[model samples]
Target: MTEFAPDAGFRKNRKLKDALLQHKALSKDGLSERLFSLLFSGLVYPQIWEDPDVDMEAMELQPHHRIVTIGSGGCNMLAYLSRHPSSIDVVDLNPHHVALNRLKLAAFRLLPVHADLVRFFATPKLSSNSAAFDRFIAPELDVSTAAYWNGRDLYGRRRITVFNRNIYETGLLGRFIGAAHLLARLHGVRLQRITEARTLREQRRFFEEEIAPIFDRPVVRWLLSRKSSLFGLGIPPQQYDELASLAGGGSITQVLKQRLEKLACHFPLQDNYFAWQAFARRYPDAGEGPLPTYLRPEHYPAIRANAGRVTVHHASFTELLAAEPAASRDRYVLLDAQDWMTDEQLNALWGEISRTARPGARVIFRTAAEKSIIEGRLSPALRAQWHYDEERSQALNVRDRSAIYGGFHIYGKAA
Candidate 1:
């Protein structure tokens, strides 16, 4: 797999009409299993979580804890595995994501060696080594997952084609980015050109000169103001309100600029490889370490050791919590999953969490609002046993990364 760069030339207009139709029709729910099953569906890429280091910092996890988290894209599951916890239960509602996680775990277990796995996932272009997949990864996948990868997309292209090719523009967030890119192109701005800058100084220049100018455009501003518009990026409605409030007018462009500004300016461009991926579409190099260390060769021993401690489930958090033994889990990572729920749903989820959480257990989650989602909502009995670290959580909030989010919270079960 060649490291996909920002300047990777896109095949212009291969299926322009279809892309437009899907883009227009991708409502709030967007891209169901039926759609994914029919689309260029291969085992999607393994990497999914954002800022593992930041997440760990926020979590303050201990070695002895058993954790539960919403699996989402599975990046965090692998990352937490690196911490060597007693156990982790990852549950998700998305079947595609569940399959992706299972495939990743299988790859970790069956790959010939770590470097082989690293090269398989981190190489610049995947087509360069069909042998890697055919020989190791493909064989390891379960039958259903294998079938998924064999499926075709809107363009009638097989999902496996993404490996030999770059499909950075495919996920929910990716599609939103594609839409934003097209809109930028229409307004005579080229995001790809700016995103390709090699240096921090160059990145700043691009953001200020090319990217910044687009925010002032009337069409961009109007579209950005709508709460439902960012569903493509997976931002829930309540979160959109919080993010909009952060921008002073809820301008998506403004919020994006502010967040990208941090990625571009706060950390060294070399160290902040995540910035490179967001802007440049690739890692700096292997010497910088595999894109995700838990997926890398060096940590495979730890991952393998901890892998057995995990159980992956496709279910709602509320449902999962209800079935778990009382006072069993020590750590819970909700990961902004609450934003998708209604008030009644939130109450139900927390009620079970309160019952299942052991004394001294810690729960961390992000929300679409700046305040604790449970503060006024949880039943008095449930809320009373959980101690909210308000001041610390506020201090830990990274405005730039969370500019699109409402808040990050940490709570401890009162002993």
Candidate 2:
């Protein structure tokens, strides 16, 4: 992990430097890592990956296609498994996410029955549900992942036990939210009420009555103007700048709150798994069970059979593609990773992607900027080989989350 001093030229932009300097100096509060660890540590948690629904549609995944995806928190990867693709390779820059994926895979492999697995993930207060870890899941985990849970936290709490106790709040993003909740409290705003609305109407009512008021506050507006404040949400300097640029100036908070309101007010609490994670920090109790397929009871056999096809690595996307045989994969999911890359990185990644494209292969990615990153960067010779489907890509995006991203693109090798 690279440790960036708050005073350092964090990125190429002067605005970002000013933004970081404006925020409070980095503190150890609840973070697992001290200063250096954050700079050098694996990404703190899984990113908000592109909508799984969007990814499935854009890929037009068939039983024959091999899929490669950045395994953020592993939710979409598990979601993809439900479709039963021929093979799925989930890679991540964070060892923690990789470990999380491995644990999910092991759960699918060893859970004795679907209902048992469902109870394990969907049950309220998982650790208190004693039958879960010892009876059904623990024996399945590999040693490395098992060790992860056994580790100690800053509080010296057994981290493995936190899974049973706090699986819902274990990621970098989760920790960020915890801190945000504290920060919001310090600001004299409350987020707890936002989660209590029982219906979409109720949700919207609450947003208007209880949440929207914060958007107009001077403090909220000030925080929105600074890029460093968003670092707590795991957004890097460049992503913060791009997101700020999207809404122009300090209005970004209003833009985000509006979208979050959509997430809260439009989707049913029962159907919106992302919202469930955000608000309640747990899955709904429907018999259909927790959202991800790897968390599902019935999918284990197939997931285990397919798990071997995955090889988790702590490498850049470009580096992984370089090591692969040409034409080795049929689908690529870049998620929002391009937003974090430089022009040279994007070109090199695209270069290898072009070389590795099988006939009709498709590459998918989301951008923080509204336009596709490849607009004029790729050589015409390379660009000509792949077809960009703008309309279809636009249609795949879910409204609430799509509002946060500039573009969702799919490039296919033309037949």
Candidate 3:
């Protein structure tokens, strides 16, 4: 099979495609649409924001379930694989993401030992990562995946060297977090101190002392007002509005402060890798902080055993779902990609999801707002097929270790 180039992920529904190609005479909506396209053109997420642990809890992954999920940064699929699902159909419209998912699946398959793999991904500064890639992962990659990672940037450094650095600090999302740290420093705050907090009280105290004051700064508030400033967070203009609405219009900074407090103080430093990555800019040393489920040695063998079960596709979720057999898939993880879709897109998506999902199939997704966008948007016929677990969703949202999103929702297909 021929490989898709890194630049090939732009193909989408005609409406979405047209939105991407909006001309200079564009109106407010047109400008917002085009900005969304530009943000997705490269690697948006170095690490995924939707917490997989919470996701697995909502989906209740079973060995018999055939899953389909958006392959963002490929972390969730890898996390899901630890459950030994019967199969996982991973789809993404971003070819870089496609390549990323491919690289991870290939690494789990080709790399000889768990420790070597850990050193390559977790050790941060390990120079031998490129060697590990060349020796174990490169040959397994398709032409496109190999080309993407090996390609050089303007500075002439190879893209593969991203692994040699703190890989978490290397993508669009990473740089956003890095900028946040820079802003905090300008306000004389050290975010990394939260990682040293030995108790929840300490974590709360550090946030009140160091992180909260920075949010009240004029520069930070001004920056938050610009949609383009948040392109690094993988948030589009539409999603930005949803978040602002959640904050009741004029309080984005306060909303962010509350969310960050949840990230820092609500979850333990030892188990909230999202917090570690945000505050410390790196996951903790082994046994110190929570590693993503797939990275832990205990789950390595199950992930490896099940890694081969994944089938990757470079297509939109709706496109792939429309092509699948009816009632064939049992678990759907939409991530927050739906937050970017139009009502037409949402109908098209859920229509196919409703068809492809088996009775009792569970769909879990996160949203920028506290409520799901699915209710009024999905047609009655399509919407009626699923039972929204509102009580559980509200409960899980509070428990989510990755506190970046405002809502965590679960919809179960009626049995």
Candidate 4:
């Protein structure tokens, strides 16, 4: 069992530093990078933004497959268990995420009923949540994980109390959404109005009238121009550059507007929890709308039965792959971590991924721009080992309910 620890010394995390500190200290970009690292060292996502349904489809997960993925909010890994993967290895650099993943896994194992699980994770501000954690979840957690929940924040509130309140509105991304809501309110726009739409046309109407014009505001445009402004979205400076380039030298505000439009209008609110989180700041009430796959009652039995197969690690994806035997893993879900990697880091990551991937293994990832990041960056020999499924990638990219990513890519190792 890997013992989790508090994130008090995240500065000492060399892998995280190497990934974020690309510019010189005191430099404009460097300062932004440092600040993002500080914010990210804490919980970034209360629930991950990527669409696990699309990911599972792209990977073609099977019962015999051994999967390795970046465990952002831990939801995707739990969702993957619904497919009955042989096992899953979840890696992340943030201790908070590591602790959260462990807590979810423990909850699945010990929580008495599906409704209990829903109350603990889905419903917000329920005072019984912390008590449920103590009675059911805590005994199943490792010592360090229990310590993490028991530990108080700077405000002196126990970390577990977030469950008793609104966990969705508590993380960096959560606070980012809250700030967006505040900005909308200042402009006389109620962001939550989009959630009331009953149809796609109604959704589009709400977005055009209530949401799209915010990007045109002088203050909003100016703020969007700064790379640091998107740090709350977990987008690093390099990824911001990629997104800006997508506008063909135009204002990034336009690019952001287009993406936000997709998020708000592309999918129906009843089906997209991502939209609910962005606008409403919480999941829909049971039977009110769809929940994440892992949170749904139908999937709970499968997830709980297979929960033990997941092993959480506080490390980088490449670092974890390096320690595994060659050709051992059959599926890889990179999320958007590659957007933060440099050419050299990309090569190192692919080198290990190529080495550790079993024959016909599939790898899936998302990008900030409408193209694969590895196009010309990966070394030829390593790139030659995998075949990019361009058509399916594009199809999946369009189907992705998250709608935040510009591209969704899948690569299959040569058989």
Q: What is the C-alpha local distance difference test score of candidate 3?
A: 0.82
How many backbone clashes are present in model 2? 9
List lDDT for all candidates, in order.
Answer: 0.64, 0.64, 0.82, 0.88
Runs in model 1 deviating more than 4 A are 1-49, 128-130, 185-205, 245-253, 287-290, 399-406
lDDT of 2 by residue, 333-367 (tens): 99877776666666788888888878889999887
How well does candidate 4 score on lDDT at residue 242?
Answer: 92
Clashing pairs in 4: none
Model 3 per-residue lDDT tens digits across residues 204-289: 99988888888778888898887777777888877888888977786577777788889988988987888888988887897677
- Candidate with top lDDT is 4
Total clashing pairs in model 4: 0
Best by TM-score: 4
Ranking by TM-score: 4, 3, 2, 1
TM-score per candidate, chains pooled: 0.80, 0.82, 0.94, 0.97
lDDT of 1 at 11: 22
> Tens-digit lDDT track for model 1 on 86-107?
8888886655566567766766
Q: Global lDDT for candidate 1?
A: 0.64
Which 10 consecutive positions of candidate 3 have the poorest summed lDDT?
1-10
Per-candidate clash tally = 16, 9, 0, 0
Query: Candidate 4, TM-score vs. the true structure?
Result: 0.97
Could you list the CA RMSD of all candidates, in the order they appear? 7.4, 6.6, 3.3, 2.7
Clashing residue pairs for model 2: 1-39, 1-40, 1-41, 2-39, 2-40, 114-297, 127-164, 149-160, 327-356
